[model samples]
Target: MTWSSALKKTARDGLTIERTRLEPLLALRGAAGVAIVVGLLLAFGTPKLAVSSAFGAFAAGVATFQRTWRPRVTLAVVVAVGLGASTFLGYLAAPHHAVFVALLAVWTLLAGMAWAVGPVSGLVATQTIAVMLVTVTLPTSVVGAAHHAALIVFGGLVQALLVVLVPIRRWGRQRDALADALAAEADYARRLRHDPTARFDPQPLMDARDAAELTRRQARYRPGQLAGPRGVAERLRPVLASLADPVLGAPAEGPERDRVRDLLGAAATVLDAVARAIRRGEPVRLPPEAMAVLEVPESGPLLSGPARRSALRLIALLGDVVEASDEPVRTTGPATEQERRDLLRPSVPRLVPVALRAVRREARWSSPIARHAVRVSAVSCAGYLLAAGLPLGHGYWAPMTSVMVMRPDFARTYERGVARFAGTLVGVGVGGVVTAFLHPGVYVSAALAVLCIGLLYLLMRTGYSVTSACIGAYVVFLLGIAGEGWSQTVQARLALTLLGGLLAMAAYAVFPAWETPRLRDRLAGWLRANGEYALAVLAVYARPAERKARRVREALLDSRAARREWEDASARARKEPVRHRGLSRSAERAAEAALATMGRVTMLMEAHLPDRQAAASPGAEEFASALRAALPDAIAAIRERARPDWSGPRRALAEWQRREGDTGVAVRGAELLTDALDELSEGLAAPRRGRAGRGAGRG
Candidate 1:
């Protein structure tokens, strides 16, 4: 090759490399800016502080990246209060050999306290540990610790203030993000629709599913902790609900219905993809084929005039903004009336009630019982430490911290316990080695400190297992610095850690904070919520209007979430050999029935309103009333296990469905509603029959 050509090629390759590398580096720089500000504040502020301000600042950065914060002011206040209180406590308990140890204890205690309140509590606890280790370890005296704590606090507060005050021009970006997700979903749906025989592709679909799941999970955290972007799940809920509706089944011989359905499905896929991308902390990317499909302008009443214009504009903006920001978009954009209508169009039969149920599922994770369990576990850990009378060092604080940090699930608790025990043993052993060979000095200690930080940052970024190993290494280093003989120190530290792990495990498993048993109750609640949402949707559908359909779609999303949660809980429960089989089976059946109900509801809604352009009919009103009335009884059946009596509503719906005249459409809807009611009745009865069959088989 010629030298000039070679040089040009090299330049092109270098530019590509630089671009790829720079994006992440820039993101990191943004993170570091937040950390530096926090570090500076810690270096100067609060004397004898336990937890560091840098932690809070870093947390603010994380929250910003997550785009979770809503009502930014509230988030800022909560963060400030939590960090300040932890710092103050640390400052008050300074000047002792075990001051750092005490700080760990305080952090765990506070975090546990927060977890009891909600998921945000756990996040706060994690931030506390990260900040304190970074900011406080350098100081030798209580006074120095306090000053560092103040500096850290200042840094965090500044970061929070900046985030709150900064007016990001995100509307265009958000709109673009939504559009991208919609376009992707539409393309996926079109592919699926066309293939007819194609099964769901687990890989691509998994990412989208994960994204939706993550959005729902993250929503449990305090509003301001992450960017308060409108989630893809929320945005696409209406569309998905419409698709699930039975009334909108196999499109009649018309291009409009087909086109709209494809668009709605594509939107669902895109939302799922966008949600997943955000959760993974990556920029959203559209599938090329899907993008190509979306670009095509298929003529249809659905894509005509203003509605079509709005969708195209929305999609174009989403593509442009997502490309420009280089960050995952948050759900902050306002929903347009047309966009909202498209979302709410009850194409899927019986969608209103089903969607409501799905949304209610989303709400279940934030329920009081779940929050209580986390809190009680935290309190229990603290109580164990105080009762043991173990010295205020790694021995007392490590175990307590573990309990507060571990998830409410048994599997997570078990893994964390094992990791904690192993890490403690290894760390103590390493500490002994260092103490025996190299005397603890300023240089050795400083080297160890830096090593600890590097290990923590790296391992934590990787996964839980690596993080456990790093924790172990850190503890060993810390013990060596405590001026003890190698053998004796190692033995003592190991024994203490074992005790702490046991106590933590006990606290997690014990009463006043039981998690496993509560799964059943949570499932029950989800079912009840699903029923309520379904009823609401039915009421809205009775009056043929876009607004009512939108409500129905929202409710269906809630039901879907509930079903997903129930499935997760059931899977977890089954993993335990000692799990209550009876309860598990009952919960599973309830979940199944709920899922079926949601699906049926989606179908019914769609059948009633096959075309959005159609005017309301009298029969639509009658069917709506019947659905509303039936919903309460259906819910009661699921919750109370009462047999569903569909005789009255079934007859009314059947008459409407079979009626033939000027109100032929209304009559058809009534017939579908009748079928839906019958199916629901069967669904309610199946669980009981299954239980009986199981019992008979066992006998």
Candidate 2:
């Protein structure tokens, strides 16, 4: 064949192959959708069912899809029990209002829990409530309800079978994504220490590190069931463990990536040293030469300006911590100082704000306005259905589906919404066409049920929106089996669904609740909490006895969480106005440093503990109490100064640090503390004339 003809053939062949590969995915998604729709209809629409089996199917599918064993099992059991109890109660009451009350109770309880606990819980709750509501509302005899329940159970079984059998590979994909994220974080952190020019924009590196951490967690939760080279969680365990290392400034070296690797490795050593010091409980001394080695400029040829600055700051901060600990080591030994304070002080100042921001950005869906908008849309959809005189089932399902898919992120919400609308439209149209051809019978319904399952499986593979659309179509088709005709009813249902989507969209966009304002306070509070917790841990560690280590460890963990929360909060605050930013930015960095220092102190504390439990020193105990008492006030001062207009808080913090002699121990502990306080004062006092102008200019 000529070259042109060959090229064309090759292109066509590639396209065909692509389509062929996609066929199974499409089929699976469609089947999953069908299964969910059929289950819902049988459980909620039919007279025989008193509880929703569809929801059970949905919960099971989510579990199978996510590959999380505990949550899936928990959700399934909870939903089953909830639905069964509601059904039994409704049956016992027998009166018209009794079923209504039971349904309301179930819906409220489930919806509330779902709102609080996330999708898995929500799925279970929604199903239980839906089934209860349907059973109570339908004018069905007890035997009929039992039969419906059987059908619902059958539908759930079908859903489970389809989900378990389908080879969608969702968990595998998620795991891969998580692994990629962790690798990126490792790369970024390594670069921060090795690359000088990289300092110009530390945000990217920081962001990558944060993403990596999140992805690591995600991987742990959703590692694919398939056997692999190493489980995602297993691969990530080393990375998470390394995060606690105090000496994170050094990197590791590889063949081509020798510089960063070496730096990370060095950092890891420092962390090891710090951990050792904290465990010892007094002070662990790093050789002067080691301190010098740790002082290498973070900004090198490979780094950017912002990244270099950030790295430099971090290294300098670590140096200060190491230097301060020197005197403490010579004096009482590691456990003489409290463990929590050592871990918390350096990190709480910087990390807390960043973590808070991350959480806010991720969980901003908790806005009241967003909730209201969804409710309004649901109400609007229901109103339209009522006006159009469509069946109660059709109206309720249309709006319920719409609200479930609504999100604060416009793009995501829109995508899912459109897919759902399309799926519903298609499902309704197909159901009408099928009803026209086949007489309503158990055999026909069962066949349709199977078809729905297959479609649901396909939809699940595609996307949530598409899945909703397929499910909608399947639900309408099932209605046909119940003697509803496709004629005008299909058109009416479509119109009502469209209305629901519109209302949901309108609610999402108009007067939406913004999380911007709360960012600052969240960061500040988190930092304060971390600082306090850290001090508490340190106090326990300072007892001069080994028994306090467990308490110190627990307190340190709590402080770590608080620090993370602070960091995330701060990061989010940066996205808003200056006043709303609070102390998040600087606080996050400081917190991280403090935590590293604390880790070192912890190592020292552990090492100093007597082999045979020794009596606690009164001096050490008094010092611990004093430090604990001072930490809250000092942290509060810093936080107060974090305000746009306040410099006084910073001054006060500087004074306190100086008076307490907080500098670990390159000098006298008292002298180091005095120096730190002075430095803080100087730093706080430095004119921000140009900086304020720039910030104001931006405003």
Candidate 3:
């Protein structure tokens, strides 16, 4: 794609508004916290104090809305405390221009590096830099700075306290995640009734697992229902796959197929019912007919051998799900203790070492995250200086815009830059009109800010542009309370905001953390991870043991993580200006399909993994070792543009089939798996620049 087309596409993307659900109660609750902080100070102390401290409450509220696994109360406290510290420190440095800029560079650097931890942490940390620049402008002595910082802390604590007191959706995130996972399985089962080769994304299960992770305090109060359903749903994946796969579970035609469909339909019904019950925190309500279908036929067996066993296992698992739901609503009982051990999230105070290790991994120059750190740190100082020299009334607006809009990627930074300028144009105008028309005093301005905050909360998920608009209006009203002109400072604000956004855009254009160049690297990482996962599954068949089962589970998770990384990199690379970097567009599509097939085959094998007492499958040990031996060579070939060494695995599979023809279901899967790997190698060896539909559909 050309630069103009990419620019137009990104611009169009930036303007697109999405439909989103609104949490009116949650939004009101958050806004009320901000309003309370602003109100109490305005009523008693002073406008400046109220406005300065309001940043803490406002920021804390914003942090709660991020897609984080951490407790909302924890987010509020940590984010607020960071803001307070940044504000106090920023105040001290404000007296010296060089020192303040230096501090900002360091802060931005750290904030950028925080992305190594997670998006939530990075976003929350970045906000502190913006707040630091804005709040430090409040003129104060050292002691006064301390006082302002304390009030900010107080304001943040107030929001956290509200999160605890109201508890609108206590354990809501966990319930939603678990329900989503169950629903996904239900959907997968329904899909299998039609297309047995149907694929399932494990993301929902991953989300449920993440939501299950709790600090010790959190684990104590966690509901019992969240626990058993997730594990049961997890086990059901393989069983569903096993039942659907022709090689392992059911035949393609006749009475067996009909029974398979009927059983699947029944299971879907049961899963959907359980999902609905969990989502609403209501009693489990099973469909009578569906339960009847689950009962084995009295006359004769519909499915023989493996299919029967799979059906029985699935029935037992569903029964476990129902039983888990029957536990008392609020329990700190044995389930709680077991879940605590199963899903322990480290306490915040204990995260220092973890943070250090994560940051250390991303510290190398080769890391895109590290490059982003350098880019943002340098851009922060440059934007601040340029905006300061332009005589803007609120110079920090320029740098803050840059900081907020700039991400580590090309698409987001450009998209958000455009959205920021456009939103600011409309937002400042609306805020200006309100202030000019009403001639409102500090109290009225405070009310307007609170209204904007409420809108911000309710519509934050709608789009980036909407969020930018709300924030712009909020800053306008907030500054109005701090004694900015009642007239719309539209011209000044827009000019500075545009300048900041442009700097952000230019910075990325100059030195980007492009996913395009890293596409091959991502694919190679995924290939290695997927190979390990497949090998682990093969090992379980070779030597079926409890320990191997654990190994298989761990390997599956690692592959899932790797797959996500590859998927994310490809998604980002699609929007990038550099379309063909390491892989041509067509090659990428084929390679992606090949990778998906590899993952799916292993997942199928994983589903029917044998019991500890079962005999080892034919050639499992030899084939697994061959795949393991070939994996490193394949990874290197992907990177070095050489022929992949699949000979070992091929020989193993051929030898197995020769010595023991058609006996091993896993051998059939391994054959298909090797076929996909060969396709992946061909994709890398030559870029398929054929007709649009041709190269894309090969896998």
Candidate 4:
């Protein structure tokens, strides 16, 4: 694409906004909470106290809203503690310049590294650092600072209380995610109807699946998600993915193609309704006509190809899910409201174990997250030192910007830097005008600050640039009460933001941790995980069905994680500064083919199991052994970057298929296992291409 086209595309994408149905309501609630707290404080107290109270309100707005009540309350408490502690320390250190600088550096580094913990912890850390920066600049005694911080904490609690009191569609996010995944699948299937060879982008589907799973996990830490439509959604994800590929079954054209297209539309419609029902907390009511499409049989005289077979399976699966969605939410025991709350209630005993595991996970120096922590700490300290030595009035901007932009991956680091700069510029301009012309009284200024905070919450997920712009305006209005005018601070912000971006780029250049170098290992991991999943699935034929299903579930989860890691690594590799950094075109194709084979194997595993007596087949055990051996060999070959012969595994699978005489569970599993092995071998065998393959390689 040309520069102009690219610019246009960026603008279009940036302007495209996204929000949950309840987001606007949440934003309003947050704004109201801040307004109420600040307004009440301003009525009888000094402007400083009122402003400090807004800090709590702003924290609540930024972190506590939009989450379930349990997490919201927990976040509210954390924000309160973080703001109060930072304020107290900032007060004590404010008299000594060197101590203050060190304090800022330490806080920034710790905040930057908090991303190693999780997304929420990182957000709170960043917010805490911002509070410290502003707090230290204020003129207050230690006691006064504590009082102000306490007020801020109170503000966050008030906001949290509001969220709990006024409930909206609690499962809106999860429902929307499942609906989007289903809709994306339907769209992919529709495209296949017109162009049978169309390559599907599984990212959307994959992302939606990940989001659904994340929500489920979060529900374990919070109440209110007890009735979320998780069961049907989880089962429906793979079914949708299976329908995306055309080569899976018989070729449909003409009337068959029309029938497939209709089915796709109907499926999308049913899922859309399911989404609405979930959001509304009601049972799905599919129309009579929609129900008719699901009745189509897998084996009929009119349809005979593999495509027909796959289509029939998809139809049946959709019907089952539709029925499942109609059932009441399942509970483990007597699941009362109190029981649900108890399950998510905080316990030190439970948390200590989880925290220990998290610590162990982050302890590995060679882990990607560890490398990210080190890089972020280094860059943030460097940015601080550079700004300190210069004449910049608010040197905190340098470290703050660096910490915000330096993500674990390359693409985010570059993208966020540009967006942050652009957004800051827009925000500084708007804030400058507001501060200079309006010269508003305390009430108006307070209201303006509240409005900006609300906008910040609403625009956060849209893009970094838009969010930063809103944040810039918010900071200007916020700092105005702290004695800094927008006119004076705007220039420093713009310049420091630019400098911070450059410093982050330089830091990565010097102490690099590029993803391309790690792609091979990630691919190897995926190979082994998929191999284990395949083995576990095949074992179902020999072992008890109940026991093997649990193993299959565990293996599938591991494989999915590995697959996502590999895809993420490949994406980052594409943007690495090094030439020919990513996999070659042929290698990428091989990886994709392997993924397809894995999907097939997963479907086979999830399919209805045959009797364990099927293990009596003479060739079953021999085939299983060969299949098991192929994965380890593939892993070793990928690690050594060498090609391995697949002849033995191929022969074993072919022999098993011939002996079985039909496509039973064992035969299907063996066939997919062979295909996956072949693909991995092909990927490993493909010669590496240099920079010449850069643009045309895997996306």
Number of the predicted model whose lDDT against the real structure is largest:
3
Write down the lDDT of every candidate, Cα atoms only.
0.46, 0.43, 0.84, 0.66
Query: Candidate 4 on 452-502: residue-level lDDT in tens?
Result: 888877666666787889888877886776567677789999999999887
For model 1, what is the C-alpha lDDT against the true structure? 0.46
The residue-by-residue lDDT of candidate 2 on 1-699, one tens digit each, is 233443344233222211112345535553464455555565557622312444445434433443232322333334445555545544444455544444454344335334333344444545554454345434456775565455445544554445445545433332343334334434444554454212122233233222223222233333222112122222222232222222221223323134334445554445345434433433545545545544654464342222233344445544543443333322122222242233222122353365445434434446543353344434433443443355433444444555555543334344555665666676777777776676556436645655765556544555564556556665555455555556755776677667666665555556443334554344445545544544443444344455555555455455455655555544433332224323233433443444334333332233223323544444334444554555555556555653222233334334545554433211122222223333433343233334542222110
lDDT per residue as tens, model 1, 509-564? 56223334555455555655565555554454454455465566556556656656
Q: Please tell me which model should have the higher lDDT, number 2 or number 3.
A: 3
Best by TM-score: 3
lDDT of 3 by residue, 1-699 (tens): 556876887888887789977889989999999999999999888988898889899999999988877889999999889988998998888888898999999999999999998898899889899888886467857987788888888889999999999988878878889999999999999999898889788899899889888788776677866757888898998898788777778898878988899999999999999998888888888979999999889774489766777888888988888888756567454444543565788888987788889999999998888988899899889988887888657788888998998888888888998888888888888888887788888877899999999999999988888988998889889888878884536667898999999999999989877777777788889999999899889988888754366677888889889988888888887788765445666677778888888988898778777778888765888998888888998898877756577889999999888877855667778888889898887776565334343333211
What's each prediction's TM-score? Answer: 0.61, 0.52, 0.96, 0.83
Per-candidate RMSD, Å: 12.8, 14.7, 2.5, 5.0
What RMSD does model 2 have? 14.7
- Order of quality (TM-score): 3, 4, 1, 2
The residue ranges of model 1 lying beyond 4 angstroms of the native Cα positions read 1-81, 90-113, 125-191, 194-394, 405-409, 423-448, 458-462, 478-493, 512-541, 545-550, 553-561, 564-568, 575-614, 660-699
lDDT of 1 at 679: 58
